[model samples]
Target: MGRNRKWIQICILLAVVILGGWTIASSVLDKTEIPKVGSKAPEFTLTGLDGKTHQLSDYKGKTVVVNFWATYCPPCREEMPDIQKQAAKWADKDVVVLGVNVAESKVTAKNFVDQLGVTFPILLDSKDKIRREYGVLNYPTTVFVKPDGKIAVIKEGLMDEAYLDRTIASVAAAGNGNK
Candidate 1:
């Protein structure tokens, strides 16, 4: 009975070490540093749902909102309508909302956007390279870039219309007094 108890304790110890090691490794690997505010927005050229190529550099003089999302994320679904509203509200104001679908099929993204009536340009990050470039570790991350092409805000998780408007206003007021 003593020998069996000793073996059980050894097994428990092994399990703890393995679990601890995995936790440490996962945290280290999963952490991709998000871009600092005020840093130059990383340049990316992605194909929109419209099949037209959209480049971040092309929208240089506009307030750009880049939102990274996946179809399976519940928070992403909840925030879609608000983002659509903001997109329309700021459409004439030179503020462009770019919906970047991370690692989701075009069909899935298209259907999801269509259901939400999202009019903003939907860009496909098929390879998830752009997500990595932005260091987005969470779904529904929104990076607001100024007209001068610098990141003004990095919001993780759900972003509401009020926050969207506020960030846009904040970015517009920053760097050379851009609208």
Candidate 2:
């Protein structure tokens, strides 16, 4: 009986070790790390509301603002005008703003943008692929990609006009140095 008990304990201990190792390995392998500053932003191809396909690689020489938002998010809605203003402000400066609507239908996104008078191209993430790729679990997340195809900043909340202006300027400056 004592030997049988010892063998059972050993088997349980071995099982625990194996399971623990598997858990750690799986977490390390499947971890979704947010793009770090100076890392290349994850590339994605999404269809904009205008029925045009927009790909990150297509805007190679431009600084890109990739903002992930949902129509139901109040902060995201509040920042639309400022984002539109920023898009216009940098239009001539080789900057592009890409608003990605998270898991929302085209009509919903279009209606919200139209109501806010936002003119920037809005992409539809029907499957939430881009949102997961960028590790954006919150609304109003903005990722700034410099002209060199590197991420400059990852902001996860509402951005005021001043913050947007300064962020764009900083990215522009970084791009200038790279050029």
Candidate 3:
């Protein structure tokens, strides 16, 4: 009886270890699953402030700039104007910058847009589905998608004009091949 009980205890311990290992491993794998430099950018559909439906797939064959932001993020506020300018600068280049408002109300986002004078489409992620789909954890995160819908760059934090220009140019110039 003693040996049987000991074997059962051992089995329980082994099960616990396996479960723990699986938990840790799955979390690590999930973290790595966030789209990388060469991965296919995840597709999403969200409504824009223009009362139009915008889907990432809709912009295929054009270089896309998916900018995740909120009105309250200071760096986002700082970089807003530059994004607006770049959108205009690169419009003829077949590049489009999409401002994905991170769960902000239309009133608040519209206020910021009005103040900043940005003409780009402001897609509202009211439920933050788009942000979570892209694994965006921070404000001012920019996902530069290549013409073929693969990610060219994933930049987090404020971006100056130079960084935006360089990244957009690189992605626009780079085809569906390696980044």
Each prediction's TM-score versus the true structure: 0.79, 0.82, 0.80
TM-score of 1: 0.79
TM-score of 2: 0.82
Better of 2 and 3 by TM-score: 2
Pairs in steric clash, model 3: none
List, in order, the clash count of every candidate structure. Answer: 0, 0, 0
For candidate 3, the per-residue lDDT at 111 reads 95
Which predicted model would earn the best TM-score?
A: 2
**Candidate 2 residue spans exceeding 4 A from truth:** 1-32
lDDT of 2 by residue, 8-104 (tens): 9999999999999999999996777777888899999999999999999999989999999998899999998999999999899999999999998
Candidate 1 at 122: error in angstroms?
A: 0.3
Which of candidates 2 and 3 is the stronger one according to lDDT? 2
Error of 1 at 28 (Å): 20
**Per-model RMSD to reference:** 11.6, 6.9, 6.0
lDDT of 1 at 101: 98
lDDT by residue for model 1 over 1-179, one digit each (tens)?
99999999999999999999999999986776567898889899999999999999999888899999999999999999998898898898888899999988999999999998988999999999999999989998999988989898889999777887787877776744754
lDDT string, candidate 3, 138-158, tens digits: 898999989888888999999
Instruction: Give the per-residue Cα lDDT of candidate 1 at 39.
Output: 84
Runs in model 1 with CA error above 4 Å? 1-34, 175-179
